[model samples]
Target: MKKSISVLAATLFLLIMVSSASAARFSIGGFGGLNLPIAQDDASSGALFGAKGRILLLPFLGLEPNFCFAKYGGKDVDDVRGKSYTQEGGDITSFGADLVFGSMSSMGKMRVYGLAGLNSNTYKREKLEDESGLGVAFGTGFEFFPQEMLSLEIRAKYHAIKVGDGGKVHLEFSGGLNYYFGTE
Candidate 1:
Protein backbone atom coordinates (compact mmCIF):
# COMPACT_ATOMS: atom_id res chain seq x y z
CA MET A 1 0.00 0.00 0.00
CA LYS A 2 2.77 2.40 0.92
CA LYS A 3 4.71 1.56 -2.22
CA SER A 4 1.69 2.07 -4.43
CA ILE A 5 0.95 5.45 -2.89
CA SER A 6 4.55 6.49 -3.30
CA VAL A 7 4.55 5.58 -6.97
CA LEU A 8 1.28 7.40 -7.57
CA ALA A 9 2.63 10.49 -5.86
CA ALA A 10 5.83 10.42 -7.92
CA THR A 11 3.89 10.01 -11.13
CA LEU A 12 1.62 12.92 -10.27
CA PHE A 13 4.63 15.10 -9.52
CA LEU A 14 6.21 14.26 -12.84
CA LEU A 15 3.01 14.94 -14.70
CA ILE A 16 2.58 18.29 -13.02
CA MET A 17 6.14 19.25 -13.89
CA VAL A 18 5.65 18.30 -17.49
CA SER A 19 2.27 20.03 -17.67
CA SER A 20 3.81 23.27 -16.46
CA ALA A 21 5.56 23.64 -19.78
CA SER A 22 3.06 22.38 -22.33
CA ALA A 23 -0.32 22.60 -20.62
CA ALA A 24 -2.63 25.28 -21.88
CA ARG A 25 -4.86 25.46 -18.82
CA PHE A 26 -4.98 24.39 -15.18
CA SER A 27 -7.73 24.28 -12.56
CA ILE A 28 -8.53 23.05 -9.05
CA GLY A 29 -11.93 22.00 -7.72
CA GLY A 30 -13.89 20.39 -4.92
CA PHE A 31 -17.08 18.31 -5.07
CA GLY A 32 -19.72 16.63 -2.95
CA GLY A 33 -22.65 14.34 -3.71
CA LEU A 34 -24.33 10.93 -3.57
CA ASN A 35 -22.66 7.51 -3.45
CA LEU A 36 -25.02 4.73 -4.42
CA PRO A 37 -24.06 1.09 -4.06
CA ILE A 38 -25.00 -1.28 -6.86
CA ALA A 39 -26.20 -4.89 -6.36
CA GLN A 40 -24.78 -4.95 -2.86
CA ASP A 41 -26.78 -6.39 -0.03
CA ASP A 42 -24.45 -5.48 2.82
CA ALA A 43 -24.51 -1.74 2.32
CA SER A 44 -26.76 1.10 1.22
CA SER A 45 -26.40 4.47 -0.45
CA GLY A 46 -24.36 7.21 1.24
CA ALA A 47 -22.34 10.35 0.56
CA LEU A 48 -19.15 11.27 -1.28
CA PHE A 49 -16.82 14.23 -1.35
CA GLY A 50 -13.60 15.01 -3.20
CA ALA A 51 -11.04 17.44 -4.49
CA LYS A 52 -9.41 17.44 -7.89
CA GLY A 53 -6.96 19.31 -10.11
CA ARG A 54 -6.82 19.36 -13.89
CA ILE A 55 -4.07 20.14 -16.38
CA LEU A 56 -4.94 20.51 -20.03
CA LEU A 57 -2.01 19.11 -21.99
CA LEU A 58 -3.67 19.82 -25.33
CA PRO A 59 -6.89 21.15 -26.79
CA PHE A 60 -8.51 17.74 -26.56
CA LEU A 61 -6.65 15.94 -23.79
CA GLY A 62 -6.16 16.63 -20.10
CA LEU A 63 -5.13 14.94 -16.87
CA GLU A 64 -6.82 15.05 -13.48
CA PRO A 65 -5.46 14.07 -10.08
CA ASN A 66 -8.03 13.56 -7.36
CA PHE A 67 -8.69 12.41 -3.81
CA CYS A 68 -12.06 11.42 -2.41
CA PHE A 69 -13.83 9.95 0.61
CA ALA A 70 -17.03 7.93 0.42
CA LYS A 71 -19.25 6.23 2.95
CA TYR A 72 -21.58 3.23 2.84
CA GLY A 73 -24.96 3.31 4.54
CA GLY A 74 -25.96 0.76 7.15
CA LYS A 75 -28.26 -2.06 6.13
CA ASP A 76 -31.09 -3.61 8.07
CA VAL A 77 -31.27 -7.39 7.98
CA ASP A 78 -33.21 -10.19 9.64
CA ASP A 79 -31.83 -13.45 10.94
CA VAL A 80 -33.57 -16.82 10.59
CA ARG A 81 -35.54 -16.12 13.72
CA GLY A 82 -36.89 -12.92 12.09
CA LYS A 83 -35.14 -10.54 14.47
CA SER A 84 -33.84 -7.40 12.87
CA TYR A 85 -30.38 -5.87 13.19
CA THR A 86 -28.67 -2.88 11.67
CA GLN A 87 -25.32 -3.57 10.04
CA GLU A 88 -22.53 -1.09 10.51
CA GLY A 89 -21.41 0.94 7.53
CA GLY A 90 -17.97 1.36 5.99
CA ASP A 91 -15.99 4.17 4.37
CA ILE A 92 -13.42 4.43 1.63
CA THR A 93 -10.62 6.90 1.03
CA SER A 94 -9.31 7.00 -2.50
CA PHE A 95 -6.61 8.66 -4.58
CA GLY A 96 -6.36 8.47 -8.35
CA ALA A 97 -5.68 10.12 -11.69
CA ASP A 98 -7.89 10.35 -14.76
CA LEU A 99 -7.36 11.01 -18.42
CA VAL A 100 -10.00 13.44 -19.65
CA PHE A 101 -10.91 13.67 -23.32
CA GLY A 102 -12.78 16.70 -24.55
CA SER A 103 -12.54 19.84 -26.54
CA MET A 104 -11.58 22.76 -24.36
CA SER A 105 -13.43 25.13 -26.59
CA SER A 106 -17.09 24.87 -25.79
CA MET A 107 -20.36 25.33 -27.61
CA GLY A 108 -21.90 28.35 -25.96
CA LYS A 109 -20.90 28.16 -22.28
CA MET A 110 -20.88 24.39 -21.82
CA ARG A 111 -18.38 21.65 -22.50
CA VAL A 112 -18.90 17.89 -22.36
CA TYR A 113 -16.14 15.42 -21.46
CA GLY A 114 -15.45 11.81 -20.59
CA LEU A 115 -12.91 10.42 -18.14
CA ALA A 116 -11.43 7.09 -17.10
CA GLY A 117 -9.03 6.47 -14.26
CA LEU A 118 -7.29 4.14 -11.86
CA ASN A 119 -7.48 4.57 -8.08
CA SER A 120 -6.19 3.12 -4.84
CA ASN A 121 -8.91 2.79 -2.24
CA THR A 122 -8.68 2.12 1.48
CA TYR A 123 -11.80 0.68 3.03
CA LYS A 124 -12.60 0.77 6.76
CA ARG A 125 -15.41 -0.70 8.75
CA GLU A 126 -16.29 -1.00 12.41
CA LYS A 127 -15.48 -4.68 13.05
CA LEU A 128 -13.72 -5.78 9.88
CA GLU A 129 -10.07 -5.25 9.11
CA ASP A 130 -9.11 -2.39 6.82
CA GLU A 131 -8.39 -3.37 3.24
CA SER A 132 -6.79 -1.63 0.30
CA GLY A 133 -7.55 -2.26 -3.32
CA LEU A 134 -6.91 -0.93 -6.78
CA GLY A 135 -10.03 0.31 -8.54
CA VAL A 136 -11.21 1.50 -11.95
CA ALA A 137 -13.49 4.44 -12.66
CA PHE A 138 -15.18 5.87 -15.74
CA GLY A 139 -17.31 8.96 -16.00
CA THR A 140 -18.82 11.71 -18.08
CA GLY A 141 -19.32 15.33 -17.12
CA PHE A 142 -20.61 18.70 -18.16
CA GLU A 143 -18.73 21.88 -17.40
CA PHE A 144 -20.34 25.28 -17.50
CA PHE A 145 -18.13 28.29 -17.55
CA PRO A 146 -19.87 31.30 -16.15
CA GLN A 147 -16.86 33.52 -16.46
CA GLU A 148 -13.24 33.54 -17.50
CA MET A 149 -11.91 32.11 -14.24
CA LEU A 150 -14.69 29.92 -12.88
CA SER A 151 -16.53 26.78 -13.99
CA LEU A 152 -19.53 24.92 -12.62
CA GLU A 153 -19.54 21.20 -13.24
CA ILE A 154 -21.61 18.07 -12.75
CA ARG A 155 -20.60 14.44 -13.30
CA ALA A 156 -21.66 10.83 -13.01
CA LYS A 157 -19.13 8.03 -12.53
CA TYR A 158 -19.02 4.28 -12.04
CA HIS A 159 -16.38 2.88 -9.68
CA ALA A 160 -15.47 -0.74 -8.98
CA ILE A 161 -13.00 -2.26 -6.51
CA LYS A 162 -11.93 -5.81 -5.85
CA VAL A 163 -11.27 -7.09 -2.34
CA GLY A 164 -10.56 -10.64 -1.30
CA ASP A 165 -12.67 -12.89 -3.53
CA GLY A 166 -15.50 -10.38 -3.99
CA GLY A 167 -15.86 -6.79 -5.10
CA LYS A 168 -17.80 -3.59 -4.55
CA VAL A 169 -19.38 -1.33 -7.13
CA HIS A 170 -20.96 2.08 -6.86
CA LEU A 171 -22.25 5.05 -8.80
CA GLU A 172 -21.25 8.56 -7.88
CA PHE A 173 -23.08 11.70 -8.92
CA SER A 174 -21.47 15.01 -8.04
CA GLY A 175 -21.51 18.74 -8.56
CA GLY A 176 -18.54 21.07 -8.16
CA LEU A 177 -16.84 24.35 -8.86
CA ASN A 178 -13.40 24.99 -10.32
CA TYR A 179 -11.15 27.99 -10.42
CA TYR A 180 -8.82 28.22 -13.39
CA PHE A 181 -5.21 29.28 -12.91
CA GLY A 182 -3.96 29.68 -16.46
CA THR A 183 -5.15 30.97 -19.79
CA GLU A 184 -8.03 28.96 -21.23
Candidate 2:
Protein backbone atom coordinates (compact mmCIF):
# COMPACT_ATOMS: atom_id res chain seq x y z
CA MET A 1 0.00 0.00 0.00
CA LYS A 2 2.83 2.45 0.94
CA LYS A 3 4.66 1.75 -2.30
CA SER A 4 1.54 2.31 -4.37
CA ILE A 5 0.89 5.69 -2.71
CA SER A 6 4.44 6.90 -3.33
CA VAL A 7 4.27 5.86 -6.98
CA LEU A 8 0.97 7.67 -7.46
CA ALA A 9 2.34 10.88 -5.90
CA ALA A 10 5.37 10.81 -8.13
CA THR A 11 3.25 10.30 -11.19
CA LEU A 12 0.98 13.23 -10.28
CA PHE A 13 3.94 15.54 -9.76
CA LEU A 14 5.42 14.63 -13.11
CA LEU A 15 2.12 15.25 -14.88
CA ILE A 16 1.79 18.67 -13.31
CA MET A 17 5.31 19.71 -14.26
CA VAL A 18 4.92 18.49 -17.83
CA SER A 19 1.63 20.29 -18.23
CA SER A 20 3.06 23.56 -16.94
CA ALA A 21 6.07 23.38 -19.19
CA SER A 22 3.92 22.65 -22.22
CA ALA A 23 1.39 25.43 -21.54
CA ALA A 24 1.35 28.53 -23.70
CA ARG A 25 2.85 31.64 -22.11
CA PHE A 26 1.37 35.08 -21.43
CA SER A 27 1.21 37.68 -24.18
CA ILE A 28 0.61 41.44 -24.37
CA GLY A 29 -0.56 43.33 -27.45
CA GLY A 30 -2.24 46.48 -28.70
CA PHE A 31 -4.85 47.08 -31.41
CA GLY A 32 -6.34 50.02 -33.30
CA GLY A 33 -9.37 50.26 -35.57
CA LEU A 34 -12.88 51.58 -36.13
CA ASN A 35 -15.63 51.99 -33.59
CA LEU A 36 -19.06 52.11 -35.16
CA PRO A 37 -22.15 53.15 -33.30
CA ILE A 38 -25.08 50.77 -33.72
CA ALA A 39 -28.80 51.03 -32.88
CA GLN A 40 -28.24 54.71 -32.07
CA ASP A 41 -28.18 56.80 -35.20
CA ASP A 42 -27.23 59.86 -33.17
CA ALA A 43 -23.57 58.97 -33.04
CA SER A 44 -21.04 58.46 -35.81
CA SER A 45 -18.17 56.01 -36.08
CA GLY A 46 -14.61 57.05 -35.30
CA ALA A 47 -11.12 55.85 -34.40
CA LEU A 48 -10.59 53.21 -31.74
CA PHE A 49 -7.48 51.92 -30.00
CA GLY A 50 -6.76 49.51 -27.15
CA ALA A 51 -4.27 47.29 -25.37
CA LYS A 52 -4.64 43.86 -23.86
CA GLY A 53 -2.75 41.17 -21.98
CA ARG A 54 -3.45 37.48 -22.44
CA ILE A 55 -2.73 34.56 -20.14
CA LEU A 56 -3.16 31.22 -21.85
CA LEU A 57 -3.83 28.55 -19.30
CA LEU A 58 -4.19 25.78 -21.83
CA PRO A 59 -4.00 25.22 -25.55
CA PHE A 60 -7.68 26.03 -25.89
CA LEU A 61 -8.33 28.45 -23.03
CA GLY A 62 -7.10 31.90 -21.96
CA LEU A 63 -7.96 34.93 -19.83
CA GLU A 64 -7.49 38.43 -21.22
CA PRO A 65 -7.55 41.88 -19.62
CA ASN A 66 -8.33 44.79 -21.97
CA PHE A 67 -8.45 48.58 -22.14
CA CYS A 68 -9.89 50.56 -25.04
CA PHE A 69 -10.52 54.15 -26.10
CA ALA A 70 -12.77 55.41 -28.88
CA LYS A 71 -13.91 58.70 -30.30
CA TYR A 72 -17.19 59.76 -31.91
CA GLY A 73 -17.35 61.89 -35.01
CA GLY A 74 -17.83 65.57 -34.33
CA LYS A 75 -21.16 67.23 -35.02
CA ASP A 76 -22.93 70.50 -34.19
CA VAL A 77 -24.45 70.58 -30.74
CA ASP A 78 -27.50 72.50 -29.38
CA ASP A 79 -27.89 74.97 -32.18
CA VAL A 80 -29.39 78.13 -30.69
CA ARG A 81 -31.68 79.88 -33.24
CA GLY A 82 -29.98 77.72 -35.90
CA LYS A 83 -26.76 79.72 -35.51
CA SER A 84 -23.50 77.93 -36.25
CA TYR A 85 -21.89 77.23 -32.90
CA THR A 86 -19.89 74.40 -31.40
CA GLN A 87 -19.03 70.89 -32.51
CA GLU A 88 -19.85 68.21 -30.03
CA GLY A 89 -18.97 64.57 -29.85
CA GLY A 90 -18.31 61.94 -27.24
CA ASP A 91 -15.37 59.72 -26.33
CA ILE A 92 -15.53 56.34 -24.69
CA THR A 93 -13.10 54.46 -22.51
CA SER A 94 -13.62 50.84 -21.64
CA PHE A 95 -12.00 48.27 -19.35
CA GLY A 96 -12.85 44.60 -19.63
CA ALA A 97 -11.86 40.97 -19.31
CA ASP A 98 -12.45 38.10 -21.70
CA LEU A 99 -12.22 34.35 -21.81
CA VAL A 100 -10.67 33.20 -25.06
CA PHE A 101 -11.07 29.86 -26.80
CA GLY A 102 -8.34 29.02 -29.25
CA SER A 103 -6.75 26.20 -31.18
CA MET A 104 -4.18 25.79 -33.87
CA SER A 105 -5.05 24.77 -37.42
CA SER A 106 -4.45 21.33 -38.85
CA MET A 107 -1.13 22.53 -40.27
CA GLY A 108 -0.46 24.14 -36.87
CA LYS A 109 0.75 27.61 -37.92
CA MET A 110 -2.52 29.50 -37.52
CA ARG A 111 -4.71 29.91 -34.47
CA VAL A 112 -8.40 30.86 -34.43
CA TYR A 113 -10.17 32.07 -31.34
CA GLY A 114 -13.41 33.48 -29.95
CA LEU A 115 -13.86 35.55 -26.80
CA ALA A 116 -16.67 36.68 -24.50
CA GLY A 117 -16.49 38.97 -21.53
CA LEU A 118 -17.84 41.89 -19.48
CA ASN A 119 -16.79 45.52 -19.80
CA SER A 120 -17.34 48.82 -18.06
CA ASN A 121 -17.65 51.85 -20.33
CA THR A 122 -17.34 55.52 -19.48
CA TYR A 123 -18.94 57.96 -21.89
CA LYS A 124 -17.51 61.44 -21.93
CA ARG A 125 -19.76 63.79 -23.85
CA GLU A 126 -19.03 67.25 -25.14
CA LYS A 127 -22.10 68.92 -23.68
CA LEU A 128 -23.28 66.42 -21.14
CA GLU A 129 -22.07 64.87 -17.93
CA ASP A 130 -20.07 61.66 -18.03
CA GLU A 131 -21.95 58.42 -17.66
CA SER A 132 -20.73 54.91 -16.95
CA GLY A 133 -22.25 51.48 -17.41
CA LEU A 134 -21.40 47.83 -17.53
CA GLY A 135 -21.76 45.92 -20.73
CA VAL A 136 -21.26 42.51 -22.36
CA ALA A 137 -18.57 41.95 -24.98
CA PHE A 138 -18.02 39.11 -27.43
CA GLY A 139 -15.81 38.68 -30.43
CA THR A 140 -13.97 36.39 -32.80
CA GLY A 141 -10.58 36.64 -34.45
CA PHE A 142 -7.93 34.73 -36.33
CA GLU A 143 -4.17 34.74 -35.75
CA PHE A 144 -1.42 33.87 -38.19
CA PHE A 145 1.99 32.97 -36.89
CA PRO A 146 5.04 33.80 -39.00
CA GLN A 147 7.41 32.90 -36.18
CA GLU A 148 7.41 31.24 -32.78
CA MET A 149 7.19 34.51 -30.84
CA LEU A 150 5.23 36.76 -33.17
CA SER A 151 1.77 36.72 -34.76
CA LEU A 152 -0.86 38.93 -36.40
CA GLU A 153 -4.60 39.04 -35.72
CA ILE A 154 -7.78 40.80 -36.70
CA ARG A 155 -10.85 40.83 -34.48
CA ALA A 156 -14.41 42.13 -34.32
CA LYS A 157 -16.23 42.83 -31.08
CA TYR A 158 -19.83 43.73 -30.16
CA HIS A 159 -20.41 45.58 -26.91
CA ALA A 160 -23.87 46.33 -25.48
CA ILE A 161 -24.28 48.92 -22.75
CA LYS A 162 -27.34 49.04 -20.46
CA VAL A 163 -28.98 52.37 -19.87
CA GLY A 164 -32.18 53.84 -18.43
CA ASP A 165 -34.20 53.63 -21.64
CA GLY A 166 -33.23 50.20 -22.83
CA GLY A 167 -29.60 50.23 -24.08
CA LYS A 168 -27.17 50.77 -26.96
CA VAL A 169 -24.51 48.66 -28.63
CA HIS A 170 -21.24 49.38 -30.41
CA LEU A 171 -19.55 47.23 -33.01
CA GLU A 172 -15.79 47.50 -33.22
CA PHE A 173 -13.41 46.05 -35.80
CA SER A 174 -9.67 45.97 -35.23
CA GLY A 175 -6.32 44.44 -36.27
CA GLY A 176 -3.04 44.11 -34.39
CA LEU A 177 0.13 42.09 -33.87
CA ASN A 178 1.36 40.31 -30.75
CA TYR A 179 4.65 39.06 -29.35
CA TYR A 180 4.54 35.97 -27.17
CA PHE A 181 7.21 35.03 -24.67
CA GLY A 182 8.16 32.36 -22.06
CA THR A 183 6.36 29.14 -23.01
CA GLU A 184 6.03 27.20 -26.25
Candidate 3:
Protein backbone atom coordinates (compact mmCIF):
# COMPACT_ATOMS: atom_id res chain seq x y z
CA MET A 1 0.00 0.00 0.00
CA LYS A 2 2.77 2.45 0.93
CA LYS A 3 4.67 1.72 -2.28
CA SER A 4 1.57 2.27 -4.40
CA ILE A 5 0.88 5.64 -2.82
CA SER A 6 4.45 6.80 -3.38
CA VAL A 7 4.31 5.83 -7.05
CA LEU A 8 1.01 7.60 -7.58
CA ALA A 9 2.32 10.84 -6.06
CA ALA A 10 5.43 10.80 -8.21
CA THR A 11 3.42 10.19 -11.36
CA LEU A 12 1.13 13.10 -10.64
CA PHE A 13 4.07 15.42 -10.02
CA LEU A 14 5.70 14.45 -13.27
CA LEU A 15 2.54 15.01 -15.23
CA ILE A 16 2.11 18.47 -13.75
CA MET A 17 5.64 19.49 -14.63
CA VAL A 18 5.33 18.26 -18.20
CA SER A 19 2.09 20.10 -18.74
CA SER A 20 3.51 23.32 -17.36
CA ALA A 21 6.54 23.08 -19.58
CA SER A 22 4.35 22.62 -22.63
CA ALA A 23 2.19 25.69 -21.98
CA ALA A 24 4.30 28.73 -21.28
CA ARG A 25 4.32 31.95 -23.30
CA PHE A 26 4.27 35.71 -22.73
CA SER A 27 3.37 38.45 -25.20
CA ILE A 28 2.45 42.15 -25.42
CA GLY A 29 0.47 43.61 -28.26
CA GLY A 30 -1.79 46.49 -29.30
CA PHE A 31 -4.83 46.87 -31.55
CA GLY A 32 -6.85 49.52 -33.43
CA GLY A 33 -10.02 49.24 -35.51
CA LEU A 34 -13.70 50.17 -35.70
CA ASN A 35 -16.70 49.89 -33.38
CA LEU A 36 -20.12 49.46 -34.91
CA PRO A 37 -22.94 50.30 -32.56
CA ILE A 38 -26.11 48.31 -32.94
CA ALA A 39 -29.67 48.94 -31.74
CA GLN A 40 -28.65 52.35 -30.51
CA ASP A 41 -30.08 55.79 -31.15
CA ASP A 42 -26.72 57.31 -32.07
CA ALA A 43 -23.34 56.63 -33.60
CA SER A 44 -22.77 54.18 -36.41
CA SER A 45 -19.22 52.85 -36.31
CA GLY A 46 -16.35 54.53 -34.48
CA ALA A 47 -12.56 54.25 -34.36
CA LEU A 48 -10.91 52.32 -31.53
CA PHE A 49 -7.41 51.55 -30.22
CA GLY A 50 -5.99 49.57 -27.37
CA ALA A 51 -3.08 47.57 -25.91
CA LYS A 52 -2.74 44.18 -24.25
CA GLY A 53 -0.33 41.89 -22.42
CA ARG A 54 -0.62 38.13 -22.31
CA ILE A 55 0.88 35.32 -20.24
CA LEU A 56 0.45 31.74 -21.31
CA LEU A 57 -0.29 29.28 -18.53
CA LEU A 58 -0.35 26.35 -20.88
CA PRO A 59 0.73 26.12 -24.52
CA PHE A 60 -2.92 26.19 -25.45
CA LEU A 61 -4.23 28.54 -22.77
CA GLY A 62 -3.41 32.07 -21.67
CA LEU A 63 -4.54 35.08 -19.66
CA GLU A 64 -4.76 38.42 -21.47
CA PRO A 65 -5.35 41.80 -19.92
CA ASN A 66 -6.29 44.67 -22.23
CA PHE A 67 -7.68 48.19 -22.41
CA CYS A 68 -9.33 50.02 -25.27
CA PHE A 69 -10.48 53.53 -26.12
CA ALA A 70 -13.07 54.41 -28.74
CA LYS A 71 -14.75 57.56 -29.98
CA TYR A 72 -17.92 57.98 -32.04
CA GLY A 73 -19.61 61.05 -33.47
CA GLY A 74 -23.25 61.26 -34.73
CA LYS A 75 -25.89 61.61 -32.00
CA ASP A 76 -28.25 64.49 -31.61
CA VAL A 77 -28.18 66.25 -28.24
CA ASP A 78 -30.29 69.02 -26.74
CA ASP A 79 -30.81 71.57 -29.48
CA VAL A 80 -30.75 75.39 -29.27
CA ARG A 81 -34.56 75.43 -28.88
CA GLY A 82 -34.50 73.14 -25.80
CA LYS A 83 -35.23 70.20 -28.08
CA SER A 84 -33.13 67.05 -28.00
CA TYR A 85 -31.85 65.66 -31.29
CA THR A 86 -29.91 62.51 -32.11
CA GLN A 87 -26.94 64.05 -33.91
CA GLU A 88 -24.27 63.96 -31.20
CA GLY A 89 -21.60 61.40 -30.42
CA GLY A 90 -19.30 60.15 -27.63
CA ASP A 91 -16.26 58.16 -26.43
CA ILE A 92 -15.98 54.94 -24.50
CA THR A 93 -13.17 53.20 -22.61
CA SER A 94 -13.10 49.52 -21.77
CA PHE A 95 -10.77 47.50 -19.54
CA GLY A 96 -11.07 43.73 -19.41
CA ALA A 97 -9.54 40.27 -19.09
CA ASP A 98 -9.85 37.33 -21.38
CA LEU A 99 -9.18 33.64 -20.91
CA VAL A 100 -7.52 32.76 -24.19
CA PHE A 101 -7.38 29.37 -25.85
CA GLY A 102 -5.71 28.08 -29.02
CA SER A 103 -2.28 26.94 -30.11
CA MET A 104 0.77 29.03 -30.84
CA SER A 105 2.35 27.34 -33.79
CA SER A 106 5.17 28.07 -36.24
CA MET A 107 2.61 28.76 -38.94
CA GLY A 108 1.40 31.50 -36.63
CA LYS A 109 -0.89 31.49 -33.59
CA MET A 110 -4.67 31.27 -33.77
CA ARG A 111 -6.89 31.88 -30.81
CA VAL A 112 -10.53 32.08 -29.76
CA TYR A 113 -11.15 33.83 -26.49
CA GLY A 114 -13.87 35.09 -24.16
CA LEU A 115 -13.69 38.42 -22.34
CA ALA A 116 -15.28 39.76 -19.15
CA GLY A 117 -14.58 43.24 -17.90
CA LEU A 118 -15.72 46.79 -17.23
CA ASN A 119 -16.38 49.79 -19.44
CA SER A 120 -16.85 53.54 -19.03
CA ASN A 121 -18.58 55.57 -21.70
CA THR A 122 -18.83 59.33 -21.97
CA TYR A 123 -21.11 60.93 -24.46
CA LYS A 124 -20.82 64.33 -26.06
CA ARG A 125 -24.54 64.73 -26.01
CA GLU A 126 -26.21 65.83 -22.80
CA LYS A 127 -29.00 63.27 -23.15
CA LEU A 128 -26.37 60.54 -23.39
CA GLU A 129 -24.30 61.24 -20.34
CA ASP A 130 -21.44 59.16 -18.99
CA GLU A 131 -22.13 55.62 -17.85
CA SER A 132 -20.31 52.53 -16.67
CA GLY A 133 -21.13 48.86 -16.62
CA LEU A 134 -19.81 45.36 -16.19
CA GLY A 135 -19.56 43.92 -19.68
CA VAL A 136 -18.88 40.63 -21.43
CA ALA A 137 -16.48 40.49 -24.38
CA PHE A 138 -15.58 37.75 -26.85
CA GLY A 139 -13.32 37.75 -29.89
CA THR A 140 -10.82 35.83 -32.02
CA GLY A 141 -7.66 36.68 -33.92
CA PHE A 142 -4.39 35.30 -35.28
CA GLU A 143 -0.76 36.29 -35.03
CA PHE A 144 1.66 36.05 -37.91
CA PHE A 145 5.33 36.25 -37.10
CA PRO A 146 7.46 37.43 -40.03
CA GLN A 147 10.43 37.77 -37.70
CA GLU A 148 11.09 35.97 -34.45
CA MET A 149 10.79 39.25 -32.59
CA LEU A 150 7.68 40.74 -34.15
CA SER A 151 4.09 39.73 -34.94
CA LEU A 152 0.87 41.17 -36.35
CA GLU A 153 -2.77 40.40 -35.62
CA ILE A 154 -6.31 41.55 -36.37
CA ARG A 155 -9.25 40.83 -34.10
CA ALA A 156 -12.96 41.50 -33.75
CA LYS A 157 -14.86 41.69 -30.47
CA TYR A 158 -18.41 42.08 -29.26
CA HIS A 159 -19.09 44.15 -26.14
CA ALA A 160 -22.48 44.24 -24.49
CA ILE A 161 -23.99 45.47 -21.25
CA LYS A 162 -27.36 45.93 -19.53
CA VAL A 163 -27.58 49.26 -17.76
CA GLY A 164 -30.86 50.63 -16.44
CA ASP A 165 -33.06 51.49 -19.41
CA GLY A 166 -30.27 52.32 -21.82
CA GLY A 167 -28.34 49.13 -22.47
CA LYS A 168 -25.85 48.98 -25.36
CA VAL A 169 -24.14 46.41 -27.53
CA HIS A 170 -21.39 47.11 -29.99
CA LEU A 171 -19.05 45.23 -32.29
CA GLU A 172 -15.41 46.26 -31.82
CA PHE A 173 -12.55 45.33 -34.11
CA SER A 174 -8.87 46.20 -34.37
CA GLY A 175 -5.60 45.39 -36.16
CA GLY A 176 -2.21 45.88 -34.57
CA LEU A 177 1.39 44.68 -34.43
CA ASN A 178 3.48 43.46 -31.57
CA TYR A 179 7.17 43.66 -30.74
CA TYR A 180 8.56 40.97 -28.48
CA PHE A 181 11.39 42.76 -26.74
CA GLY A 182 12.43 39.84 -24.58
CA THR A 183 13.90 36.46 -25.43
CA GLU A 184 11.54 33.78 -26.71
Highest lDDT among the candidates is held by which one? 1
| Weakest ten-residue segment in model 2 by summed lDDT | 1-10
User: Tens digits of per-residue lDDT for model 3 on 67-167?
Assistant: 78887757666564998766655777766566667774333443344443333333343566566555567777767777776788777777875544566
lDDT for each residue of candidate 1 in 1-184, tens digit (9 for 90 to 100):
7787788778878888888899867899999999999998889999999999999987888899999999999998879488989897699899989888998644358889999988889989998899998788999999998987899999999999876667899999999999888676
For model 3, the superposed segments whose C-alpha errors exceed 4 Å read 1-24, 76-86, 105-129, 181-184
Top candidate, metric TM-score = 1
Backbone clashes in model 3, listed as residue pairs = 23-58, 23-59, 75-86, 75-87, 75-88, 76-85, 76-86, 76-87, 76-88
TM-score of each: 0.93, 0.78, 0.70
Off by over 4 Å in 1: 105-108
The TM-score obtained by model 1 is 0.93
lDDT of each: 0.88, 0.74, 0.64
Tens digits of per-residue lDDT, candidate 2, 22-131, equal 55586789999998888564577889999987766676777676889988776554557877544555888877677788773223668888998766677788768877
State the local distance difference test value for candidate 2.
0.74
How many residue pairs clash per model?
A: 0, 0, 9
